[model samples]
Target: MAQNKLAPIETSFSKLMGVQYPIIAAPMFLVSNEDLVVAASEAGGVGTFPSLNYRPPEKFKEALTNIKSRTKKPIGVNIIVNKSNTRQEGDLKIALDAGVELFITSLGNPKSVIQDAHKNGAKVVCDVTNLEFAKKVQDLGADGVIAVGAGAGGHAGPISPLVLIPWLKSELQIPIIAAGGISHGGQIAACLALGASAVSVGTRFIASKEAGVDIAYKQAVVSSTPEDIVMTTRVSGTPAAVINTDYVKKLGTDLPWLLKSLKDNPMTKKYVVPLIHLMGMKALEKSATNPSWKTVWSAGQSVGLVDDILETAEIYRRLVNEYHEAKQSLP
Candidate 1:
């Protein structure tokens, strides 16, 4: 298939991925759907989705088929290679067989994914929050690393993008894509200037119309500000950024007392942590599709930058147009 022509501005990542935009519509769990993927790809950014979003597992293949039918541009799929996802291997096989062009991995070691994706002639990028794990993924053969910084929407690392981008750039040989706290073209330029090849933007897109999420979810993302976001381990065993609605504040930011004790116990933690992840994911999945389910919405500090729901295409237009203005304004 023919690749997208170069954008007015280009980077190593955009060129490597054959996209016009130096951006990846960060694979969001439950939020990225056919329409969103199609819109992002057509808008010249890398469109990605989490394979586990398709329940029954069979629906994963259907999603791949449907997305491919809509656009010939290769799309990305995220796989959770951790103990919590029992179907990781099956999902990888399905995506590879269907000719998935890229794989973005998170929440676990990506060694196996890198091997399989390479064999299939697809590139793999791993999410990294720290230098130690970032180096490990590089040695394991990730095509790039997405530096998911402290300000990211979901499960994020403690490092700030300002520090992490340059930190990883100096040590790792592969390209680094910055994530977290980035909602505008100026932010994108700042990341690129900070030694990143591109960016993986998530929270802002959640408010886009093509996102197959509840209207209430979209509205909440628009209405909420940076201060409204807080890190909580209650949603998952790992700390994740979430909207601090009255419901979330009432639920509290940590695990309930019993779950906490189980997670802390040496003998039980091994098993309990995965169970905690599964339970938390179930809650997010439920609350994302409906507003009445305790409203456990996840969004980054950048949520404050989102003011209105927009078509995915319109969002891209603003981003690309703003990018030019920002670039020109730079000294």
Candidate 2:
């Protein structure tokens, strides 16, 4: 695919983000890296990686510099805005200074982040699971909202995109990026028709060549179906969608009362929750790096639609073609 080719589908979000396609390679934790981000941007969509992917502030700035050197296309960074993210402010400062123009805030209130981002001449988009949160972010001056509905990979929402996207569009003036159970061009077209300004794709990108996941994980995504996906709260304090490996299956779906209390109670959370979150992080890290399929593998219900591992550029091309074809087939 030609890097300069304009996408057949266009939207205000695409224009605002300076991308050809109204698509964002959702900032998948650990999985999204500089290579994937560059590939997605070069392929006409925006790409983002989690801020925590780079540990030290300096390292994160270095990665941002590298991404800037590679492509002029727009890219984004995801920040976990909750109390647990002790490095949030520092990371945001580094990214803003490094000229990152788009910030995606998740897992907490984005009001402060939105203010800072706007001050830096950047845009803030918040990941929201429900209408109330979506409206909250919009009121805070968010540039957009990503509706992370049920069936999305990683920490997913309980609502379905079928219901969430249109409702958010009807209620909010900001652009709605529909996420969940979207993999094919037909699904992208459907989302666009549903009043979404763009679509956020996660699981589908795991199979892309530029994704940093293990080859085994990519193959698992290709071979598995929606049945292989399960929701487990064991990986983190919150519910997350992960592949059902034997190891994952052995873990409980809910935390114990004590752990749950520590995770939820503000007073206890400061001391206890971080330790629990650390243990969970270690387990996930081991699973993602080790050779065993028994380890935790994250994927969404869209895994059923993924049939092959292809380059990120190729994936974008196919999606564009598929979207056009689907549109033509529509009555």
Candidate 3:
């Protein structure tokens, strides 16, 4: 189906993905479900979800089947190609056999994934934090690179999109897809102007109707300001941006000094994030009454831009409308 209320936004990335809009509803963990992916594709944008969201391996294929049955549009899946995720190869095999259109690789070398995906006529884009990694993936034959910046939700990079997007665009021949702190159409417009092929939006959609999180989680995304978002490596040992609820404030505080303390204490150093989850997040989530203090949720700095909950299709509609308005307003 096409976007009926607005004209299509064409870009090299959108054309490659066969989506009408120059947006990729970024693959999110825990929040993205089949409903969200289908809605995004039907709304004229590429929709994607993390393969890790499906557990027990069998369910992953079931998810792919469900999404494919619902929509014929091109869709994507996120795969963590790192050492910690032992299931990477298995997930990659299932995704390839399912004829997944695109693969978004993160954390580790995507060399093998790019080769296999391309052999199956699928495309691969790597999530790169810096120019060194981006250039390496391009040389490995990745179809594109997603420039993840500091303001991104999970394992965010050190650079800003303002620097990363243009830097990758100038240095790499492959398309550069900008990610981090992008929620609104104007922000998307700014990325395009900065030489991004398209913008991969993650956080804003967490509040959408199709996201399968608790209503309280969605509400947190809506009500929180940018100041409520903070970056800490405490939860997962990776620098990730998250909503700073009372629980995180109390436990995940002043991460640098705490990290220093943990590193010196060999007994606690190995335990770090997992030990904290066992001590804090798990306990609060199971027994707490205050919704804000119960669960730690991931969100980008764009939480400030997300003010309301809407269906995924509605979110795409409003974004396209806003993109046009922003473009027209520019001199």
TM-score, candidate 1, is 0.96
lDDT of 3 at 246: 81
**What is candidate 2's lDDT per residue for 50-133, written digit by digit as tens?**
988877777888999999999998889999898788999999988888888799999888888899999988988999999999
Please report, as a residue range, the 10-residue window in candidate 3 with the lowest summed lDDT. 281-290
Q: Name the top lDDT candidate.
A: 1
* Alpha-carbon runs more than 4 Å astray in model 3: 254-292
TM-scores, one per candidate: 0.96, 0.96, 0.90
Instruction: Choose the strongest candidate by TM-score.
Output: 1
Instruction: Encode model 1's per-residue lDDT on 306-330: one tens digit a residue.
Output: 9999988778877777777788898
lDDT, candidate 2, at 40: 91
Q: Point out the worst 10-residue segment of candidate 2 by lDDT.
A: 1-10
Ranking by TM-score: 1, 2, 3
- Give each model's clash number: 0, 0, 0
